[model samples]
Target: MHVEWRGRIVVDPELHHGEPCIRRTRIPVSVIISSLADGISEEELLEQYPKLTREDIRAALAYGAELLQPKSI
Candidate 1:
């Protein structure tokens, strides 16, 4: 079962042990976020992960932001 998150991110129990990853790829969202936080440029990321697009990177960021938001009771 594959569940879409933030459009480009996906969570599939069959993939990466259900860690949220970029849709259609095994690259986890956390890897993307951490790479960027470590000062890896967007262009470099694209080069490193040929399957990823700028929009996909944005989606990862959006997904992370969404996860950080407080939930109302």
Candidate 2:
């Protein structure tokens, strides 16, 4: 199955064992979230992962937030 989160994040069985990742990049969304949780700044993230942009970081956050929302019956 193919899953797209916030249009910028995607999950494909062929990549990272199907983990959600930024589109066109191998960087996993969980990695971004974890890094931020560990106190990494957005600028630092950009510097560390040059392939990522500010919008990509925001998309990761938005995707994570969407997952945390309650599911309706």
Best by lDDT, which number? 2
lDDT of 1 by residue, 1-73 (tens): 3233567888999999999999989999999999999999999999999999988898898888878989989
Candidate 2, residue 45: how far the Cα is off, in Å: 0.3
Question: What TM-score would every model get versus the actual structure?
Answer: 0.91, 0.91
* Per-residue lDDT of candidate 2, residues 12-46 (tens digit): 99999999999999999999999999999999999
- The residue pairs that clash in candidate 1, if any, are none
Off by over 4 Å in 2: 1-5
